[model samples]
Target: MTESAFRCLACGDGHSVAVHKAVADYFLPTGIRVDYVRCAACGMVQQYPVPTDVGPFYAAYPVHARKSLLQEVTRRILLSPVYYDVASLRRDQLLLDYGCGDGWFLDRAKRRVSAAYGYEPTAMQASRVAERVGVQVFHDVAALRAPLAGRVDVITMHFVLEHLTDLSGTFALLADLLKPGGTLHAVIPNLDNVEYRGFGSRWHGFDAPRHICFPNADQLKPVLDPLGLRLASDRFVPFPNTLAASLSILFTGRYRLLPFLAFLPLAIVWARLYPRGTRALTFVKHEN
Candidate 1:
């Protein structure tokens, strides 16, 4: 890989300091080490040379297929708050779940909302999910935007924003897709979480190469401000899966759920008290 000048994706500032190095992917045996840096301008952490060829990496992504009962339970627990928020505000309205892997969330959401659609970039997975869930699955943004632009009542990108490389452009597109007073909800790993400080490079939040940007509220506000998407609420939302991921890296160098089960009690307490490993933010498109 060729060395290029470090540029902050969040703030557009060119100055930063190496914060973490030699971070390995816990999912794959790629033997790749990633370096993460913190931008001085906005305190955002990001990976450099942002993995352009990510298709091969996600070929074996576990979530692309069916999940076990335990996995489903934990996923619901982690996303309960988001579901509640969406349900309260988007009752009987149109909803879209971007990056809807396997359409699990979209499937559940369809029961609550008047209409639910999903967009997944992976063609095979999208087709499989659309068939399984009986909900429309779009393969690209254009397909999603063509029908729903400026009409979607609720749009979600749960645990999806960090995986995107073009943060600014994506937010701009989301702003366009949302109707006035519509909500855009997102869940992302918090770079400032206690687990990140404790685990450092081994932090599950830094799922190297896959999670390209580590954004905080400061990093996100500037991008959404000009687009008329005001930050309505920001809260720390912890997921026990992160602890499981961290322990997997420490012990087996891969993802496993045994540690997660053992840590469930402590994870619950920590989630209530700290709630920092992940964050949920709601951005509302202002009515003009």
Candidate 2:
């Protein structure tokens, strides 16, 4: 509702509007109230005064938690197609799954591709992935670059970009890692979602402190084009859980399923809309 000197993390725009102000009611990692803003120029939504150390917020984060055998099997059957199609993965191509958590996707992807690698933020996760999946996982940028620079054919980010602080720097590193004609595939939550309108700060998409930014697709075009990545395909990815989770926060204080049989149809309708609750975008690196 108000404008200030907030510097947008994605586009460097000065003009912005205060969007939401809320405590971490759902996550409760920190009770401190955080303010969110959307850049008027770029339409990127982000938190103000980005936390100095986000470690505490993720202290109990289930980002890489092991899933049950049934959960793992369900994920393989349902989620693998999204990445494979977006990346156009082939048996001859090498893949690097940036922010690969638990290596579940990479575990299967390695079986299909010529080679597969992973990048995680912690040594514990990197080690778990290496042992469990037998796929090489790296936490050091320098070490990753030494081997992968201009060699990887595809890189994937699954609900990972929003948690990162450095958008520009991350894309630059992606450009360095991918070969010409390579692909950068991602799945991101859409702020344009009708759920955000209905739930406001309580919406799961806001996810407050952990999810730092929600950059519009248009703003990403200029950010990626100069790095030799072109937006090749963009479409909404159905996120049935968004509405249910938001409703849970509205009724219950934490994340748990509530029978909202009435809203199921609305979630289905919103998923098909242009400005959906979630989206998948595929960008192809230009061949020089």
User: What TM-score, over all chains together, does every model reach?
Assistant: 0.91, 0.88
Candidate 1 matches the true fold with a TM-score of 0.91
lDDT of 2 by residue, 33-117 (tens): 6778788888888887666677666766665788889767746654654454634568888999898988877876787788899
lDDT per residue, candidate 1, 57-142, as tens digits? 57678778798897888778776764435456446699888889878788878877888888888788889999999999988877
lDDT of each: 0.79, 0.77
Q: What lDDT does candidate 2 reach at residue 71? A: 69
The residue pairs in collision within model 2 are: none
Highest lDDT scorer: 1
TM-score of 2: 0.88
Each candidate: RMSD to true structure? Answer: 2.1, 3.2
Ten consecutive residues with minimal summed lDDT in candidate 2? 255-264
Which stretches of model 2 miss by more than 4 angstroms?
1-5, 28-32, 77-82, 86-88, 257-275
Tell me, by TM-score, which candidate is best: 1
